[model samples]
Target chain A: MCGIAALQLKDPALRPQLGSMMHAMLCEIVDRGPDSAGIAVYDVERFVHAGQSTVTLLDSPSSDEELSAALAAELPSAGAVEVRTLGDTTLVSAAVDTAILTAALRAVAPGARQIGRGTHVANLKGVGNPVDLAETFGLASVSGTQGVSHTRMATESAVTASGSHPFTVDDDLCLVHNGSFSNHATIRRGLRAQGIEFDSENDSEVAARYLAMRLREGDDLTTGLENLRETFDGFYTLVVTTADGLAVLRDPIACKPAIIAETDQWVAVASEYRALVDLPGIETANIFEPEPGEVYTWEF
Target chain B: MGVLNEEVVDLHVSTVRELNSALHKAHDGEHWRVTNPGGAHNVAVGIDSEIDVVIDGHVGYFAAGMHQKGTVTIEGSAGTGLAENMMSGRVHVKGNASQSAGATAHGGLLVIDGTTGARCGISMKGVDIVVGGNVGHMSAFMAQAGRLVICGDAGDSLGDSIYETRIYLKGQARSLGSDCIEKPMREEHLAELAELLAAAGRTESPSEFRRYGSARTLYHFHSENSSAY
Candidate 1:
């Protein structure tokens, strides 16, 4: 089993405490998954900025200055590249399109494994206790508008950084899964025929790639997930974060656990109630489980 | 609420093991007030005494599980497996419940005031489950022996491949599982339903509900009917 804790702050005042709150929620669900973990934060100013694109990679071979210099040289039009290290991941921000930025980074750091890329997403993950990984990433001190986290139990793949979830293959679209897909291999073959490359042997990575392909084909977040529901068969409880909002979906049987809590201040979803109990207004929040085979979306 | 001889145990201040140990060794007449549950799993589990417990907040998985003799109440919603394999007791949930609210319970009365997630009472044995609100999918799948009373609607597969269990549904079911069908209600079933409603503090008439049970079609496997199994 895996664990998930995602929080999207509606009130601007609550943004400053996004990291701390998600850390608390993640800590509560750590017992569900202790093999490896990942987190994604959407902070406009910290991860991405106005008219700029951001991409994070796990363990780049070059230093910050070297990577930044190479990226700037590769695409002179993409000016002023900034690179910083958090945990074992590196965050690179540039004033250019996400495609252009990521392409340039790929040319410069060919061996680096990209984990997150978008206008407002930062990803960091590792193979250890989730709380320890959070501490290394300074998750408690980071500020953001929304955050999604996952702790993996490693059913369909090896315990590697690339296998950790919050799979941000698409720009500003991060998806975390709590269950495995049974027919993913068949779907993976279909997606591969469509030229959607995968980075790992994990089943959840197949879902992330499938969603990215759907969004690229003009499917909205909810519709992409709905299409996935009809295409893939298995138990799944997913919480996906995009540039503008968050959405949650479960399989028809709904064997996996997911509870959603919503209020004016925030909208939160977790694999268990233990994750949401520490929120500021959770006692008064309207909490309910999402209906099976239904999609719940919240736009910020 | 029992101030005369009530003992308040705050989960924040004491460990869950400490609380369960106390409840297991407590006297028959003792009343306990558990505060700040914080959705912790296995809170007050495996109790074997005639004690009264009231949890002030939400609980995690398997709360009041394997209970022998106790009256445990949750003021908030409960997580998965609210009271699995309970020998004897009364568990009350004031809010909604997650998946598998009561699974394989040998004996007890579990009452949920709000709606529940999927598989509310799968494979129950000799327990009585009363839901004031709707139950989720596969509410009583393969239930061996029990009485399930649903005041609201039921989700998909109300009782799949059930055995000996009696189901009383007041509202609609999305779909019925194999070997489970609506049975004609008679006088004894109505009387038993009325008593169950009263035991759960419900006021709905027994006539308003519909009874369901196994058709016994798949009970004895045969060569000609082997495909259904």
Candidate 2:
């Protein structure tokens, strides 16, 4: 029900055009999501820049009025903030310290986590098409060797910014998920009991925070994602981004779709073939779907 | 029918790249009769224009993927994925089709005249499928919407993990998959089947077909009962 796209550029020069490539990939998947849009870009030298703040993961689609009120309460008391409501969701963007912003986001949306931090290298997400979000957010100009994105249709959740893909758990890691989670409530309750607070009710955030928790427990991203292959229920294809590499994982059932295509200079992954069509010099032989329950990684 | 004089476009000699080019050249909403189509894969791929395209012979994999707003008729048997991911339009097959017919299609209608292989109309979304003969195993697996009509028998694991789609079968089904069950045919169902039968040009009475769909049993997963299906 959602579209996920990422690029692991081997050359830094490609960063400037990252937004455009992401835009192209997202455009093909416009049908998947048409609610709201956002993007996160990761670069080697600078701190990650995530445009738009109103993005949240919710359990179900809410009303725009409800989101506006929630975001207003989440922001710092003294800071100037503007909340824009899209559907049953609200986005609040501000020029503030990343740490403080993260804290405020968590304070307001207690269960919501700030997934991208100073150390996390992957920038991912989108409300509609990942491609369109990238274009609107100026991601095409980015020149990173690796990245990830998503276009969500809200199969389980409602069509709102909070239900969009790319739920971040900590600063260093973020995840974009396609497919539904059967045991999301169970997992959410388990995590909540262990003191893991959540902002949105989205099942995707539960999985993302789970991986983040595993990372905090000393498991590498690959191992953390692989461990969940059998642990979670329903169909899922997850793309994880880190400073060193881009990782892709699918559920054991492989019920959903995720394709991979590689060229001499770049390796690209998407939910469908059309998303990868615009890649430079892509041929029929270069395209293939990721095996179910398997994880594919591309290093920077 | 007045000699349906039309230029037959053969896909065997054409690549997907070339076929797409020709498909774009045909004016939107215009009728261009086609024929002599061999086993060219991905024919009529990504067609969004509202036009009519007919193929005379057998086809290969993904024959009409991403189709939108038009009519495509094939006189012979079709390969696997006859309408993979089709967005809209109608595809009629005079002969049987291979596996995964209309896989992941979002909308439109797909008609098959002969027996279909495994996984017919898998994960179909809002697409109507009609088959004249038997359908293979796992037919209508994970279907989301639209109607699926079978004039003959169905294989094992029929309608597994189905959503809100409707399924009509005239013959026996080996087994029903997860969350699917047989229901008593109601008056409304009878009327619906009559329309489908008329569209497929079948004279069979509506009473001959049994109705099957999601039983609303397994919407959510339960570890203890998951194995029961």
Candidate 3:
């Protein structure tokens, strides 16, 4: 069992409270996923800066200053490398190409695994009690236009930073899942045959990779998930967020819980309504669980 | 005996366990109001006393589950397993309900004023369920005995592998499950449907509904139908 929460603010007025709102949601679902936590933020100013690429990775043994100096020497064209650390995740930013930055990141911080890369997103992951990790990361202080957080119970993976959800394998994309996939092993073999490498043994990573592949192939968010429903077999309630949108989907059987609440200002989806009760304007929001095998998306 | 002075308990202030513990020992004819439920779980469950309860907001899983001899009125929506395994009494939700609204309920009347998710009355044994809105897929699956009245539509596989239960549907079903066939509604069925509708405070005419029940083909084991299982 896992808990998933996501919010996409339609009105910029509510963006300032994005972190506080999501933190409240995390607190409500801490009982569901006490093993670990991960979050992906889509704000430009508070987490990741605009007009530059940011690469998120697991914490490195090397200090940010040392990594910055190594990165500066590696790429002369990329100017003024900056670093930010939150809990067990670190963000490295530069004005260079994301691919080159990621390649340079591997040489400088060999121990760090790049989990996410984008100009508008920052993925932070840690292994601990999810609520405590959120506190350690200072989630309540960050501001964002959209974000997704996950608390995990570790059904199919070990309790490690790499095994967490919000598998942001692709740039400007994030995916979090709440149930296990019975046929993930078979699907993983197929994707591996196509030269798509994976970072961990978690089943949710396979889904994230599959979605990224589909999105890269020009399938819109809704069609990509429909393809996932046909190919993968098992129970899942998932939330996928992009630079400009957020999407929620449940497997056809849909036994796993999910509720969605929408207002003029924001649209939020969670594993349960408890995660959304403290949100502003929730009492007046249009709330309902999505139908089985249906994809619900919101664009900011 | 619990104190009679506790007439109202705010869930944000008191715990769901405290309310349930108080309800377990409640005196007959006692009334209580719960405020700010905030989508908590297991509210007002397992009570055997004839007490009245009103929850002011949405609830999480298993609200009024395994219930008996109590009336739970929820003013907002409910999460999964709403009123599951109920033994007796009445549970009402003024808003929509999540999956398995009344699974494996042995007795009682469950009233959902809005749409219900999948498996609305799976494995029911004698409880009566009235849904004012649509019911999702696989509703009444393997139902042994009961009556399910849906004033709105039903999703796919309605009443699959059902037994002895009667379903009165006012709207269309996407598809019927194995061995669940629509049957002609008799005068007695109309009388019972009308009674259930009235009990759930619905004003729909009973004549607009169609009755469905088990074909009993799965009752006797047959090798020819083994694949259908």
Candidate 4:
């Protein structure tokens, strides 16, 4: 079993405590998965700079300085690049068009894989204990308005940084999965024929790419996830996040466990209610499990 | 023995093993109280002797699982597989429960005061499940023998490929699975439903409910039923 925790703050007053709250929630589910952990945070002020794009890269082939210099030289329209390295992943923020910068970075560093690029997302992943991964990355100090974290047990692919979750293929989009996909191989081959390149052999990454492809083709978040429910097979409880929306979906059978608690100030989703027991105002929150094949979406 | 001789284990400081060990060592007619469960999994498992256990708080997965003879009550919600594989006994959950609440239980009385997640009584052998609130999809799938009573609505694909298991619902059903159909609630059925309701401590009238069971047409392979297969 794996663990997935996501929180979307509805009240602006709780923004300052987002990181610490998320860390505490993540720690509660540490037993669900101990092999690797990853987190994606979307903070408007801290990660997102006005008129700029933020990109997260995993398994970068070059050092931070060299990568930043290469990115600057490749995109002449790009302004000063700020880089931060956490484990094998790097976050690079630049004031430029996101699509253009992503394409340029792909060409400049083919070996460097882009996890996500958007206005406010900062994705970090590694292979270790979730609590230590959070401590090493200083996650408690990184504040955000919305966040999604995952602790994986390595059921599908190798336990590598690239295989960890919070797999994002588009700007401001991320997904964390708590169950395995039975038809991933078939879907992977179909997507490959469509000229989509995959960075790892992970099934969850395929799910991320599939959703990204759907969103890129103009399907809304709800429609994209509904299509996922129809096309995918096996038990899954997924939490998908975009720039301003959070969506929770379960498979038709809903074999995996998931609980959602929503209060006036925030909506928190986790593998179990224990992860959310300590959240502020949790005693008064409306807690329930999402029904199978039904999508619950909330927007900021 | 005096009343103070009863066993009381607080899960806040004591582990699940200690509670289970205490229950295993207790004799018949003994009573036990487990406090501060706090949603920890696998509490009071594999009890074979007739006894009484009351959990003060929410419990995690497989609470009172594989129990033989005992009356276990949880004052709060339960996680997945709450009374799975229980041979005989009674388990009561005061709040909602997760998926597979009584999966493959051979014999027992499992009651839930709140709704339950998907597959509430899947593959039930001979247990009786009563849910005060609604149940999720694919409940009682392939159930061999048992009875499932729901006071609220049931989700999609209720009782697919079911066996002799009888289902009583007081509210609407989203859909019925293949080889399963609505059956008439005769006088005997009404009496049985009343008995089950009383056993679960529910006050709903049995007349408002309908019964469902297997069609028994798919017990053997037939060329006309190939599409359903």
Best by DockQ: 1
Per-residue lDDT of A41 in model 3:
86
Prediction 1 TM-score vs. true: 0.97
Off by over 4 Å in 4: A44-50, A75-77, B1-7, B222-229
| Model 4 chain A weakest lDDT span, ten residues long | A43-52
Candidate 1 global CA lDDT score = 0.91
What ranking of all candidate models by TM-score puts the best one first? 3, 1, 4, 2
Between prediction 2 and prediction 3, which has the larger lDDT? 3
Query: C-alpha displacement of A77 in model 2, angstroms?
Result: 22
Point out the higher-scoring one by DockQ: 2 or 4. Answer: 4
Tens-digit lDDT track of model 2 for A82-122: 44332223334444554655566565665433334543353
The lDDT of each candidate is 0.91, 0.70, 0.91, 0.89
Comparing 1 with 2 on lDDT, the higher-scoring candidate is 1
Q: Which residue pairs in candidate 1 collide?
A: B126-B145
Model 3 gets an lDDT of 0.91
Clashing pairs in 4: none
**Alpha-carbon runs more than 4 Å astray in model 3:** B1-6, B226-229
- Higher-DockQ candidate among 1 and 4? 1
Give a tens-digit lDDT track for model 4, residues B64-124.
9998997999988898899999999999999899999999999989999999998889999
Which candidate do you rate higher for DockQ, 1 or 3? Answer: 1
Residue B159 CA displacement from its true place in model 3, Å = 0.6
Candidate 2 chain A lDDT trough over 10 residues, lowest sum: A52-61
Question: Which ranking of candidates, highest DockQ first?
Answer: 1, 3, 4, 2
Model 4 TM:
0.93
- The list of candidate 2 runs beyond 4 A from truth reads A44-115, A120-132, B1-80, B83-229
lDDT of 4 by residue, A15-53 (tens): 888899999899989999999998999874665676788
